[model samples]
Target chain A: MSATLEKGVNAFREVMDAPIASFFNSCVHCGLCADACLFHTETGDPKYTPIYKLEPLKKIWKQEYTLLGKLASMVGLSQPVTDAELEEWSPLVYDSCTLCGRCTVMCPVGNDITYMVRKMREGMAASGHAPAGVIEATRKTIEQGSPMGILPKTFLAQVRDQSEETGIEIPVDQAGADYLVIMSSMEIMGYPEFLGSLARIFKQAGVSWTVSSEAFEATNSGIQIGVSDIARQIVMRIVDAAEKLGVKYVISPECGHAYTALRWDGPNLIGRPYKFGVVHVLELLDQLHKAGRLKTEGKTDEPLTLHDPCQIVRRGGVVAEPRNLLNMVASDFREMEDCGSYNWCCGGGGGVSANHRAEELRFKSFQVKKRQIEGTGVGLMVTACANCRNVLEEGLEHYHMDTKMIGITELVAEYLKEDKPA
Target chain B: MSHMDLLIWARGTGLQLALGVFVAGMVLRFFEIYSLGRKPDLSTPRPGKAWAGWKTIVSRSFPHPSMAKRTYPTVVLGYIFHIGFFVALLFFAPHIRLFRETAGFGWPALPTPLVDAMALAAIIGLLMTLGYRLYHPVKRFLSNFDDYLAWTLTLLPLLTGYMAFHHLLLPYTLMLAVHILSVELLLVFLPFTKLVHVGTIFVSRWYNGDMLGHKGARL
Candidate 1:
């Protein structure tokens, strides 16, 4: 019932489907993934090599699946995956790697190294090798409905504050709404202005939307901790909330993993398609702008660059939506090199920011983003994901840089055209 | 046995045994990979997106422009080694003759000198790659017995083949027998080692592409 090495091995067995089998078999160990990863590039440590991080998984595959490997095991030529080995590898599996998909794109043999890491975390979590911070986050997500342990009452209070500030009555559990807006714990706690921004924009755009009193938490700590059952439970709350409200779409808040959890992984996790469509908040804004439902009066002349979140841009495929929204609001937008889908991670994705033990390494890896920001020579940076914004802020503060960050949705709302609307 | 006898055996029984292991091993390896069927993606794919998997199959072969600076040498050398190896294997006159005899088909062969040049290039590329693997921190950390074994297995045939063609290292009959035997050894081991990537690379690329493509990511 609880964590064990056998259970971990069994989880590994369960996760090893055809693609994984093919990937393990196809790897030539070219080490090109190392160059693609910021952790490896910044640290100059070969242990951070993406494929090397999957050594545990690769060992399991070889021992369990291959003929030569089977023969080797029978003859005592190979060792079984042990608890000590798993403990030793916990940091490599969870701390250093961010599941950014950059290494996945760069693999010469096309091995999806990030996918393997995501799957490998399942085994790590089961075997009691997962980082304590992420596990605690998962526990909080289940017990308090937020990774930050934000209770429903606290979320409602923030909602009330935002509604009062914006002078818009933020709907709560309103059935027959056109959309259901979900917020990650970070957006609710660290950046409540996103709520106000959404309210102002939707009021002007003439859209019908509501926040779920029952399922306001959008981030999935189960995903961060690598437990599918818990992830499915988290997704079902939003699904239930949306279906009960009979909304047409669910808007994922300005969070990277939240969008990935809600839009891409949610259906598969719950084993069914949702009654309502899921859209990133940026995507909805882009759609509203393109359809002429949303209008902007002015563009900011201050030069700024965009930080593309790995999960939302590369993994979730909401690439163009942010660019579309940013162009409408900014006159001096400079793109970082490898902008859009190929942009570097904030070094805090995939629970690295959530895992306190990884703080030093995460800051070290932030050097890549620092160089990227410096390359743009922009004092201001706009990003779509609240988690990325928080991480970027901390990185800038740690490095004592004066670079500033704002969420793209809030930036767009700052330029909203003033007009008469009910 | 005499060099003549060794050459006869390499051209006869050694060829059959190598071919048999190569075929059976590949089938078993493919079965191992494909048998564990994956779950179908249940989520609605991004609508109106082209099949990016097919594009990725061709596109991934070229270094991503953003990654080109960091990866140029490795990718370029990888291409030279693979392309040169294949060119020498399939385009050499003697190789085509052997293919015609075994495969019941033939393609036009490049001139002997051209094939020789390709063989030399392949040898140089592989040597540089081996050096890179030894010198590069990540590659050195990743290398194991299998990587070294695969490398040696691959390089032996090219070295022996070139020597046999030039009659440089040994008597023609002995060198030819050594070349055929080295090629046979490579064939026998191909499906068991990382060299199996020669076939599974396409499958791996397709899966990566398809998963990302389903999300409408331009891989």
Candidate 2:
């Protein structure tokens, strides 16, 4: 083989040899993942097909990773792809994909395209091929500990500012709180209403929850940036805080990927089952609703729709709670056509919203959401995910679609006692 | 032509064509695999995801009463098509004869009429599956050329193969090659495309079963 061919061959091996690369070895390419994918629907491009998305992974598995894959890969059963050839895969893998885990929901083979997308991004990034914004954000995350490069002291200062503005105490290293609630950094930087609604709900629920300014942010950009150990490092903030604080349960906020990390994969990342209970906001709301603790008020009588965040609704099996909570609140609640676990992605997930180059494609790629929401004329859209909230609110904003965005907590919070402008 | 000569020739033609396609097509698949580019993912652990293949089929997939609660009920419907399709594949008599001579294997075939009925049932399943892909919004969104191609890949082999075997639509011998070709195409496609689910579904169901059961959640 020529040097370039050798480089191409080496690239194939580097990808094909890893265990994560071997994970595709487990996928039998059943199209059960089709319904969960967005690009397959949005562009009608077969190459953007979810199962087809795994084709590169599959070939790697068949070629160099598995006993069978290695045999197949070595004997020219599979082709060696050049860096340029693989570069063409960047948009299909990054911009066009949300890694929302919708496809992971229905995979009869349980192949997680989200994880696969993350892995592929890692490879792309290693080759210096990631999207520009992602590369910048990743550098900031690695060097500055947050993607925004907000100093930890600055983060602490933001908490102080929030407490001043809202008169709600966001705690740090409080010794004996019963709950160590973790939230995404976006709550501090952008969407403090999530924090406000959460504080309101937590207050009503009568739980002793504290947010650690030291290790408070729950949304680990590293998780989406294709750095698992770094992702694990970022997620360790909450667990470490919970252990130190002796909090009873760690409440993960309404951010989808954050919830996925804190609630589902938290224990695994921590290298043991969690000592503290991890409760998703939806689950918390569900419990409150079941207990009749949540008194929902001001459910608009106009047509309303519920968008299930991929984390809570699909992978987390939290289909009914928020809707049930919404129905309990909103008098005229209506459902988007394919709501619940079978829903399409909101075109912004797995860090796609942060990838500036992919932003334009994000709205166009949200064809599934658009079609589902088009005929409904829903004035209000409710969801449990903060990122879903941010993305869809922005999606509607970009499209100039007439829809208002609110979280389940927004409704649940309304039923709570407001300490008037103290 | 003597019955044995006709049998040998028919058998030889089918067997040789199948082996050649299976071999040559398999090599092609491997070439594609080697040429394809992918990336490393060593950070995450691959779960052992153990399950007894036979047992999980009954609990998780076949009588998947709870799977209806899943996002894709077509998957349950899929199991029916797969089971019935395989029953026809393994038990059809003419297929038994061809494999016995060429591949050095033989299994008892169902009675001729019973096999014919099973074939019809398989065709009906193919139709039901096709109808679902066409009508359901989620399904419609998920499909591509490959998805439609899969439907045809599933339906055509059963339709033409049945006709070839039963003397229903065309003469038995001529359609047999095409039937065999479709089966061969399926074999090649199976390891390559979404059709690979034939192999992965059982293991995945097992993996899913183990994972869900561990979580005290449903598959």
Identify the candidate with maximal lDDT.
1
Report lDDT (Cα) of residue A29, candidate 2: 33
**lDDT (tens digit, per residue) of candidate 2 on A147-180:** 6776678777766776776677776778788877
Residue-level lDDT of model 1, residues A1-422, one tens digit each, is: 48999999999998998899889888998888999999999999999988888888889999988888999999999999999999999999999988889988888788999999999999999999999999999999988888999998999999999999989999999999999999988899999999999999999899999998999999998988899999999999999989999999999889988888888888899998889988889889999999999999889999999999998899888888888888898999999988988899999988888999999999999999999999999999999888999999999999999999999989998999988666
DockQ of 2: 0.16
Off by over 4 Å in 1: A420-422, B48-50
Pairs that clash in candidate 1: none
Judging by TM-score against the true structure, name the best candidate: 1
lDDT of 2 by residue, B35-77 (tens): 4443321122223223333344455443322234443457656
Off by more than 4 A, model 2: A1-36, A66-78, A107-110, A161-168, A292-303, A417-422, B1-84, B90-114, B117-197, B208-218
Q: In model 2, how well does chain A match by TM-score?
A: 0.85
CAPRI category for model 2 = incorrect
List the lowest-lDDT window of 10 residues for candidate 1 chain A. A413-422
